[model samples]
Target: MLMLLAAGLLADPVPVYVIAGQSNAEGYGVPHAQLETIDDVTVVWPGRAQKEVGPLQAGWGANEKMIGPEYGFGQAMQRHHQSPVVLLKTAWGGKDVWCDFRSPSAGDFNWAEQQMKTREEREGRSRKVGAFFNAMVDNIEVGLHQAQVHLGRDDLELKGLVWFQGWNDYCQWPVEEAGSPCGRGIIERYPHNLKHMLCDLREALNDTTLPIVIGELGVHGSDVPKSRSGWALRAFRTAQSETASQLDHCCLAPTASFWDTQATDHWECHYNGSAKSYLRIGRTFALHLLALDALPDGQTLKWQASQKGLQAMLRRYPPKSGGLALWGSSIFRLWERAPAHFSEFEVTNVSFGGARSWETLHYADETLFPIQPSTIFYYCGSNDVNAGADAASIAERFRLFSELTRDRLPHTKIFFGAINRSPEKKERWAVVNEANQLVGSYCETQDGRTFVDLNQVLEADDGSTRQDMFLPDQLHLTERAYEGFARVMREALEQKVQSP
Candidate 1:
């Protein structure tokens, strides 16, 4: 019995693909009369039947009478891999990324407070932010356990994720009606929200390089009508494609070509409940997953577009020598009026959104060499902390970055900006504090190096992250917070300049 158990443990793990999202992912497809079952593929759809593991076939969609893309995805995967596969599905109808499917990294939906309060008052139920996201995680866990049992091996691996969502976000009320904090609708922030969802999902699943295949929001098909809604659909589809393009190990499966005008069960958003569309989309998604291995390394491809954009921005506004340079992630990149704050110095911002420490090092040659700035105010590591890097590792990356900067510009003074604490990252505060301490200690070792505690001004009197200072997302800072940061940084710079 012991030897048999060991053999079972050593057996090759079954590859499981998690298929999740909103209505489209849940599948409104009318089941085919004669559905073929892929015996090689097992499906654990907790959303439909609790922990019931079965063969891949019809009745796995929203109900027993429907079919989802997983049907075709499993078919294609089985045909290509010629091995046992698991389709672990968790999906819900009418979900939106802005709130329902919001990821942890995306932070709270503060702008929806009034709406939530009203709903709670009326329905006596409060819709918490990231509700669906948490549910998805829990459901995936349940599915994974069932998969392990079905495969008779504890080593079952979740190989990929297929996401098909976006209609609700695209249908968000206009700025005038919603009156959001940033004056932006869900559609406007859809790309950023979607990216965070994917990244945070990966982190939660402990598979940072897991392949993701997104079904582009091609509901209206190729011949999009000329109207307000049509234009919005085009924009939304473009945003979906753009978001997929930025992330590594992720690809978009085009669905517009598969859109059938004659296959209407009801609403157009569900691709008219077309079995052909869902099946084709699933097959296309499988093809993309197969080809994902050929893509560039995650580290190299991550934020490649933002890195290239930074280079382009620098070319357009060439940085002059003997000036100040601001380096970091989206926090610094989004500060458009940074130059206005540093009036005494020619401030050039080379920061980019979603940048990690390694990216900073990756583009050092292009960002630092040309400028040779007299001073650089650095604000990074928040992303690194979120990416699960240890404090020591973050500090080491900073040291390496400083060394590279000092090598070319020896006289340059580098100031390390303290990573700010926020309500969103409250759980990870300990890690953030440790990273700040490690980086601060390293800065104290050098004469020209300094550690600026920008977080001080951004915090409330109670020492908690000031809710008002942060944007509705609860991660990025508001203009008031940036102003405080500018004031503190300016004072710090002046004091450092005057020191013997």
Candidate 2:
């Protein structure tokens, strides 16, 4: 191992991937001997010791007899990047997110602990909630330090995290007893708890946009009777999926489909101890990470130019104290050409083409919130639906965006533009409509937020987009479409101005 380190083949700033979860994450599969021979890959199996590093191998599991997803994950990453790869594996079997790895920011688990009747009962389960989180953080720091010393470089980058644990939170506790001290009712709280965990982890690591890939729970082929736990697992899975969709630089890897009964240790939830299953999940995670990493680091050239223009406009004719801002994707980008009638009020176009709700949320602090617009005409979600996001995920992310904006700019009123139909993305029209309904419903419940219906004018009598109003792509708008959108937005803002 020392000789390998001496080879100095790794590039400066080695890419480090952290894999954390419970038993499944701990790897129940039998180790493949060939994994230990992989070149340019370092495995930090903390379960093996406080500071253990070597070529990838098995024995990273809690039992020290099995391998987990890290084996395959490391291999996949190594294959993709020319630079050396480091696998930091930190997980324990039978650990729950509500208690074992619960983040401090998620709030105290005292309510859940108080449910225990006796001091002895409480004491028995009194381990800190973020115990594993602390361990993982420590391991990452130490791993980086050791790598810097041994690898002879200071450019080690903590690239991403892979999360696979949720069974404990969903199965061990009864969903029926959620909100009670006896159980954290983690099912209902899973999404929020998971979100808090992600936020706190990023803060601790000092990378707000660090990419994270969450693996869905359970082995699809397991004979474990889901007759009782099936609904609970589905609920937990939904929470995980929705959380990923709602956050930027986060994605979900469907691992249940990779479950192999032939290799699983326990058929119920753990992927059969099959090395193939773990390998597939790991590769899937790596692929998703690679895809996210491929996205442009900033807005496209055209959008950047548009942003500069908007800035110039703000400088020339500053909004009347708190003015109006139009925000969203391509539809709103073209709306930048709205009729001069919009100039009657202070208006700035902040839209970026192909922007998703998560992307909007990610840059809100810099782009939307700081401007402190009195009124925001928001149009987003079609791109997300086009990207395969479900209606629930789109709605959930938009909710987060709206809430964050409202929190930062309390006086600002928001008008959510219903997504316009696109003939090119016809298959996703249902999802778009559902997302619009969700957004409209949420706006209806808020005090300063209103839903602006663009479909009335943008949609044809047949319920498809108006052919003449769209560009050749059928996704973007023509001058006629922008005219219609501008008219609707102006009317909505006027109504808000006149009310009371």
Candidate 3:
């Protein structure tokens, strides 16, 4: 028996993929029919005996009838790799990133500590931070070891991680509670905490550049309305994108488009608990992993649109003499819908949706220099801060942008728009204010530059943004807000243009 076990332990290791998160990762999918099975794939999930290992199929959830992303993910991996695969899944329902899965390396937040204390009082146990993180790490380790022992092979390679979470964090706490002096909520702290979690996991696993695929929390489909919760969700989603973009060997799988409202009896946002929804998400996750695997070392996957279309647009609509250009992120993109006219000067919109300050720096040649507008109206940096960048980093990026503009268009009048206050980022207003100050200071130093303040019009007396001025997502402005923005922008531009 010992000789046989030794031989099995020495065999080739199988590729293992670990999936961790909250309820979505645990899956609520109710399969319509018998789920397909992959012979080459196996799964180890938390069970009555700490964990249970079985062939990859639909019954990985708490109940045997339920399924999650793992089912489809395993099938997809088997098809692509054509070898034995192991999936280790560890997730709990209603867990937030700020506390439940917070990484050990990310120092404790007072708000999270308070919540932990509350829970401790109620449950009569001292709950530690990173509880889920610890459980996940331990389970993955145990699952892999068990797989090695059961299969008699020492070759179980940990290939990747699939994270599908955030809804809990978005809904658990109010944005006001995340404000300074108290501490930040999970939504505000997500990107930084997520980055820390990724780093910590990689370090623990002894793989510095482990591949990771983060799934977007898409309970409501693509057209997320502007509401308090919608605002929080959008913030979390933006953080997910930024974390993936900044890290190496990482990719993001969008799931909002796959949501089916009529499928399940549960919450409409939970993809209606549709098995098909989970399956599609899982397949997409696997595909992204495969794509990442195909990339060369030090090269990260770019999930966003390429700059080719923007470049083509620039060529098609070259800036006319005395033209004006509006550039920034989704804020400017939405402004394109406004019927406001620029009769005094031709206007061209060179903005892209979901653009960050760093992205603006990179595409300056295509979006900025070529247009060479007489005046430029800019509104960005919110996404950068949402993506975990500090005020200093945002200021540095803006400084670079300013330098670039001066170098290319010395005569151009640059109007730096202060990053707007939003209900989604109520807790982060200080950072926004600091970034605006830096940007304003930078503009003042330039010969033909000025700063436009939107907070005066958008922010309420209590410092909270006016809810009526924004849509359900809370980040994007309402039509009314845009009108206000237009007035401010036009007034500032007119003043600058008329100045001696």
Candidate 4:
């Protein structure tokens, strides 16, 4: 290793992940003796008084007799990167993001202020508002110092953050009445506060694009009861998902799917104190972090995050192979009524917003190949053209896409949807038209490739772009526009595609 480092072959900086939240993040699950210590990963847990920095093992939980999500999370991180990993864990039991873990930008925590006053009166000193947040930042600095000493290297990158919280904000602060004060106070503010916390942490670390994984609060399990408490939990989970969706380089690991329903290890809110539940949650978090990290340059982070959630959905409810797949950018993603439009067949729209041709190719293996759809309506390259990619390059990407699809699903038919001449890209309309022409020429020569001219329905009688067909953004389509596009697709599929 020293020789490799001297030769600059092992110069990649070590990845340091920060894991912080409430009790669950602190850990409560039981650890078995068989759990191995990962040598490549170093955990700096400053939550304890000793502030130990060492190899990750089963015992680094809330106590020696228990384990937390960090155990599996650290191991998976090390395996995925195959490099030295450092974890900075600073979590407290029964803490809430709206108060105890609140960041500076989340505003003053009134409840914490009162508690601080009381504690200061009793004791000589007390932790101020946003105490946990402050401690977390302080611990991260300490962890980095310790990590540099432990590894005998100063090159460490804060790669990701793992957050497993929401119990106290959801369950502890129940919103019984519709539009209750409690609802607005904590539940409604949860998403905003969490986003602020992440942004604030990023600013502190000076890494704007730090990847984050939020563990879904699934204490009530998959089947949340039809009660006030259940409703609160559901809302909290939604808030967490929404925050992850809105942020770049962030994803949510749905722990409800990995719920210990049988209570194999034990039973209670902390995932039934089940090691299996914690392990699964940690692994899922690692997978999401990996997905975010693996996104190619210029590929949108939120789209990969969206793909992560969509993949989970596909796993839980696998789509039938040999169906109609509408894959592309926002044009197809915003078509929520796609199923009703293509009622004739099983249609799966795996499109995402702001997706370019290259991004589609990058994500095709994981998102498109799994279904191996019989036919596809590919609507992309609009973003690419807008991004200044030449017509030839965009067309070649489509050719590459077709080749990949042919290799995976030999008999699958592909329809290259012409890039829409939307008002948003009026300046690049010339490039869009040239790219469409190039792709059309290529598709005509291919065996199973067809070019569906969407501009036919999208344009008006005078050969001008129909402004009414577009939404206010001048990029996306309106309801009437989708109707016309659907009609064109239905006709093409019926006339061109033969039944299996």
For each candidate in turn, the TM-score is 0.56, 0.56, 0.57, 0.62
The lDDT of model 3 is 0.75
Clashing pairs in 3: 8-152, 9-152, 13-155, 219-269, 225-472, 226-471, 226-472, 226-473, 227-472
Using TM-score, give the best candidate's number: 4
Cα RMSD (Å) between model 3 and the true structure? 19.5
Any runs in candidate 3 off by more than 4 Å, and if so which? 1-13, 46-51, 110-126, 173-184, 297-500
lDDT of each: 0.78, 0.71, 0.75, 0.78
- Candidate 2 stretches with Cα past 4 Å from truth are 1-12, 31-36, 63-65, 110-123, 175-184, 220-226, 264-267, 300-500
Q: After superposition, how far is residue 389 of candidate 2 from its true place, in Å?
A: 24
- Global CA lDDT of candidate 2, please? 0.71
TM-score of 2: 0.56
Better of 3 and 4 by lDDT: 4
Residue ranges of candidate 1 with Cα displaced over 4 Å? 1-11, 47-51, 108-125, 173-175, 178-184, 295-500
